[model samples]
Target: MYQVLARKYRPRNFNELVGQNHVSRALTSALERGRLHHAYLFTGTRGVGKTTIARILAKCLNCETGVTSTPCEVCATCKAVNEGRFIDLIEIDAASRTKVEDTRELLDNVPYAPTQGRFKVYLIDEVHMLSTHSFNALLKTLEEPPEHVKFLFATTDPQKLPITVISRCLQFTLRPLVVDEITEHLSNILNKEEIKADQDAIWQIAESAQGSLRDALSLTDQAIAYGQGAIQHQDVKDMLGLIDRTIIYDLILAIHQNQKARVSELLMQFRQQALDVSLVLDQLISTLHELALLQYLPELSLKYSAEINNKIMQLSQLISAQDLQLYYQVACKGRADLQLAVTQEQGFEMCVLRLLAFRPLQPNEILVSQTQVANQPIQPAQQPIAQQVQSIPQVDEVQAISPEPETVSAAVDHLDDEYYDDDPFNEPSAVQAIEDEQSSDDFLEQELESTVEPVQVVQAMVEATPVQPESNADQIVFDPSSDDALFGMDEELAATSPEQEAEKYNSDDFLFDEIAPLAEPALSEQTKIPVQEVKQPEVTESVATPPQDSLFDLSSVPAVDAVETSTVSTMPQEMIDTALMPQDILKLQPQVLEGVWTVDKWEFWFRNSELSPAVQELAQQGVMTGQINAESIFNIPKRYEALLTQLQHALEQALKSEWPNTHFQVNYAEVETTTPYTMQNERKAKAFQRASDLLHNEAAVKDLMQNFDGEIQNIQLK
Candidate 1:
């Protein structure tokens, strides 16, 4: 029967153990010095020579000729121990003998002297599986064992061992073999077995082992068998489910070039070959990481394989370092997400798609040419002035007018002498400064000019400009103070003016009264309005100033104003009261409110309670106050004020149609939490009483119970 390569080429001695020099040296020195501890713990990951070292230590301690670091295998003690027949040397698998009784029975014999060898050795493998009780029973004996008995413990999970047990034993940790070490070891094994293997094949096997010598040997064994005694790169690659490195490089290049079709073709090829999608992604991520490293640190770039090195160099040149980092992050995240994907192929495809989506487009030369062309102003066949105004919104018309200030000022100056020369406009001396301001203003106007229809801007501009009444334009407008005719006509006016004034007053009053009743009642006297009084000189006389019908052209006053007025009247009462009627109601039209509160803000406020809910709630809760000074009226906490401000703005937009020019500031007033003196005293007394009761019922009782667990049950406290 031909034995498998893993078993045939197993390390038989300390010198043969791979990748654990520190552990080997310590065990060897301990044997040579005759300073061996009774218990030794070998801890490491699988395939790192944990069990191999344990057996070697057993052989060293039990060698018949002498306890030598290099045990003579021909000796009776060495051969028996190696062949597992030595009476004094016992090897126990803790994984199997994990019961407390097993440990107790085994340790019961520990006190006896060795039957044949200098020291009796117990090799326990996978010792972490021992039960708590078993560890407890072994702990005492392990701490202080007889001189002739030796204990060697091996475990992959040292963390599971009781700290007490760990403390009692001497520990040696075996490190994983590096790729070079594993490759060299595989090479020597292949030579010993007379198997021909490529250096790259050996290296691939070594890397696939991930720093485990046993695993590396096992993989090499499989490769040799697969190749019928001679290992090659293709055989190893097939066995490990690895995609060809060249194909991987080509795939990465395709991704870098953003060749979506080529990338998809490669993925299909991989699928046809039944390649592990996750592993392929893993390798890709690893390759990208290596490339990123090369881009940053040229010195560390020497270790990769020739193909990988070449690919890294090419990638480093093709992609910017920042883009490379981004691709690396995307690949890494894709690798993680792949695990959760329904299928590895789907995950891999998604990762590829993500890379494609995020990859920056190469600068198109054609785009630059087109941009240059677009930059050259193409004059329209018709004049754009009328089209520009029509394109801009009425509100933005103000900003549009700002840019032409100098030109308008110049126009105004020309008009000043010809029309009204009392005020001469100053010209801005710096044309560049004017142009800079004009550019910014034009940018804003362009947005409006493109979005707004020309008719609206014209209509708005006409509406916004104040025009003198045509009748008053020719009349000598008397100063109100100089016009005594107005005062003498008061009695005559009362007879004629009562009905018109009453009707006008009733209309205005009815509009305000309609919304006021829906508002939250005014808060208590403590919450006062912070109103500042402005005293204006009284109009001493009434002048026949102007007629509405004669002012400019009454025909062009716009039906929009009536529509706006009706809209404002129809708004929700709460919104009208809170946002439209407070102050500046004349200026805040529905369109202005719409612009101020974008669609997002409107939706946000509509979902929340109507404006002034807090104040209303406070009034209902009986916490209202009427003191209106700034500190007293607006001292509410920032949290409440923010909530109120948001609500107020939303209300403004909602009710702008009803009250076009309303302005209100949300004021938060802080209220002091006052505790009554009687309540405070009562609380203090209760706290003291509770403390006294706790001392007597809990602390004192605990002390008494602690002192008397039945030893002094009859004793009574004074």
Candidate 2:
């Protein structure tokens, strides 16, 4: 039978063990000084010689040639222990035999004397898997063992073992073999095997092992076999599922040039070969990191094989350091997210695309040095003095393309002038005042003419009337200055009266009278004359106008009540049909009005208007409300302006300014209400209170003691 390389080359003794000098030195010194502890613990990662060291320590204690530090392999006791036939040297697999009964029976004979060698040795492998009860049973023996017995414990996870057990033992942590160490060891092993292997192949296998000597040796053996007894770089690469370093260089170069097709081709080749997607991403990230390191520190030492070093050097020169750092971050994130993708191919494709998208553009071939002219800030420098006479017109091109600040400022000023000219209310106040006076005079003249004939007839009647008739006429005439006369008229008609005209007359004497102020009598007397006869024909003609042609009777128009309507139209359709429809519909809506009637007639009556009580109250409340609502409506737009404003302010203050403006838009909905209860806090408080009470309760203390059976020496926070 052909013996496998792993078993044929297993270490025979402490001298044969590879890359564990610290552990060997410590154990050898302890044996030399005769100060050996009762128990020894070996801890390390996988394939790092934990079990080997444990076995070596056991053999050192139970050697047949009378307890020497180095076991004499020629003796019968050494041969028996090596062949697993020694009665005193027991090798126990703690992982498989973890029951309390097994541990108890094994340790029951620990107090007895050794039958053969100077000491009986117990070696336990993967001791972390032992049960709590088993650890308790072994703890006593581990803490205080017989003088002739020794215990050796090996584990990967020392944390799982009780602190009491670990504290009693002499713990030794085995370290992983470094790349150089593993490589040197592999080279010697390959030479001993007489396999023709490349130096680069050995280095590749060592790096792929990640720090395990056994793993490196195993990979080296496979590489030698895969290459038909002559290991090569390509054989190791294929065995490890690693992409070629040249291929990575090609991909990175393509990315630097922003060449999409080349990048796609490389990714397709990777897919065709069925390489591991995550591993490819990891390789790309590593390459980028190396490039970054090279750019930042050109003389930094690298551990890559010589076959990869040349490619890395060329890549570092091709891409900029900043860009390499950026892509390195992207590649790292892509590698992490690759596993979450639906398929490895999809993840791999996306990662490649992401790299292509973020890669920097190549610099132009025709490089030029920019120079500052006259210390007036660099203005492209007109292609420099040396290149001004070039045939390419580069100097003229720079001067022609450069924009001056004076020209830009002139253009901006022209735009500002145009904006101001477009404003309808930008006319001077003097001009506006003159226009207003002309319009008011024209209106007053029309009104005076319409009432002239009636006034003349009424004055003639007042003069021709007798004394008793005059007294009655005086009572009917109106001076138009008395508050009582104005108040007595219909409110609708009274509001239409020219209060501006009344302000022209003095009312000091009219207000001092007690018997229905004289202004009332004067206003009544002016109105009592027989003027209806003179205006009968005009009134009949005016009344004959069609309803559609005539404006609504201002005197008869009723005030709008605050009743809800299914369809509300504010301004009359006639006004809308005649006025120019604004280009921006949003700006056409009336923003403010004087009275409730005007507001109802304009903004509040739109059919689709969102007129809630909250919005209406916000609009009508006061100066502060108007300012707050206006800002709220503009900043945090919503139909329910009041509630939305409050919510937005609260959220903004809670999150500081991190809250987004889009989150407070009108289309975004408001939360109706929030309940005031949190289950986590309540449950935590209840649990803490229960624990506190249990600590003080005599009954609970008694119950714990009864159930555990062991004495409660102390209850610690840990």
Candidate 3:
């Protein structure tokens, strides 16, 4: 007869229990001191000595040694209890007969006297599965059980048990065994059985058990049988389908070294083997955590094999602690979101590549002591900021990078010089002028924020530079005092007529250096008044006359409605062929506001937004819920929440800036609903349809398409 290792090595006494010393000690002292409870409850995870402890306690109560903690194995009562034949001790599986009728029938004979032992014991395993009515029926007898009887209840999930039923019993929580504890116990068992087994194989079984000794022993039994009474690491790995630790070590090493090729190769191997990717991520996360632990506490002993510890040590030394922490977090998030991915392999590969993407920059992370010393600011020997900025080129690289010479746009270049170096406090006129321009730094920041290339600053400057009309035999001069047209003409085509100026600025190379910038026209018109004259260059008969060209002349751009063969003379031939959004500057007007809640109103609000990204996103996804005197309420999605305190303060300031004395608040909306984004999308769709119809129906477009074999891929409107 083959006795399985699990049953063969089942602990028989209190001291023999593997991991639950606290429960054992408490029960042992209670029995030794003649103190006993009517009922006892044992609870923990599966195979963690819960039911086994219950049976052992039953034997101790019925043993011929007169109810002692250490049962006499030789006695008939103890032997019968051990072998499941004890008349006074009853072991029940509550999971099967969980009905109230069964519970009532079982409790009907509770008052009966013990037939053989000094005290009768009732052991019920998996008691949590009992029905609600069954618990109510058993609760009375459990609370007021006969003095001669002992009740022993065991369950893996104590939370499922009724509080009324659990409170009546002496609860003892059994802890899951650590890996090292299970490993040592299995080694002792294997030694007694005289079975040859590798230490690593035994550790593998222990690790796989996940803190359950019975499961570990059961796995060891299966391993021994599979290995023909001999356990080896290779055989165990083959049976469990666990990825080899060496592969994990190599993978992590490759990742830390940023070996993309090796990482891809290893992932291919995993895919070919049909390995579990989620499990691999879990292991990677665990290994990263261990490496992080070893970084700070290098001398600390870990409960793993020497090979695994060596791998951890190597990784700790190889990867920085910050990088390890980052890898661990990414791995954890990947594992949690693994099910959301379209494929497990995609999720796993992304997790691995993400680690590479966020690898710590060693050069930037660690600062030299000399650099730190150099960064210390000098207080007493501090020089004027202007002198420091101009004379000391080596003082700051940032200072040297700025102050670049003028390029195409004199307006932007002059503004940068005034912004970066000039003292705005000393020059009140310049201060007012800068304040009126709304700070050129702000516009530069907005453009630069969305740009990646450093040369874009110069490119944007070139695009904004104004062009002067080419010098001819005649020159036009305007009076500075009067608000009239060019040369003091007071018609609608006067200097004050923006429409006439716009048309001339586009058609003719008129000087706009004295005029206001269109982006912020109000202040530019009021404060930036300048009278100018153009000096015509004398023509030479020997020299050839050159055609005039102006960079970024926005006024000359033709309208979309005017995209016909007739307007081709004034507009460029290329623009007609590649024309896109061409909204007329003459017809363009600021959107009318309803000053109340509606879809159109929301569109207006979103169009005129000045909110931070976090709150702006909230506003875009939310609908206006309510409004008080000065405060506006918005319903935001619960899943997408803002830091309410920070958002409240920001929105308060923004609202006051836009509409004085106004305040705002946002809260998590209860119901899911459509938002302002939906309206914006609807608007975009209609506009797109209009553009597509106009392009496909146009006569010039159809002729071009027929002649050039060209097709419109997309259409956009400004």
Clashes of 1: 29
For residues 1-718, could you state the per-residue lDDT of candidate 2 as single tens digits? 9766666677768888888899999888888788788888999988888877776677777775655579888787777767678888888998899899999899888888988877888988999999999998887778778888888899989999999998999899999889988888888877898888888778888888988887887887788779888999888888788878788888888887877889889988987898887787787787788788888799987776676787788888876666777788878888888888999789878877888776543433111233223123322323432332222222212322233434333333433332335432222331121233232223333322223222223323333433221122112222222223323333323343355224312333222222232212222323543322223212211211112222212121111222122222445543322221111111234445332223222232221244455453433321111221122122222455557565445433422243233222233333232211122233344434433333433232443454445344433221
Candidate 3: segments with Cα more than 4 A from true spot: 303-308, 360-718
lDDT of 3 by residue, 16-116 (tens): 88878899999999998989999999999998998888889888887887878888899998788778898988888898989999998888888899999
lDDT of each: 0.61, 0.59, 0.66
Off by over 4 Å in 1: 301-308, 363-718
Identify the superior model by lDDT, candidate 1 or candidate 3.
3
> In model 3, what is the error at residue 700, expressed in angstroms?
51
What TM value does model 2 have?
0.52
Residue 296, model 3: lDDT of 86
- To one decimal, what is the Cα RMSD in angstroms of model 3 from the true structure? 18.8
TM-score of each: 0.54, 0.52, 0.54
Better of 2 and 3 by lDDT: 3
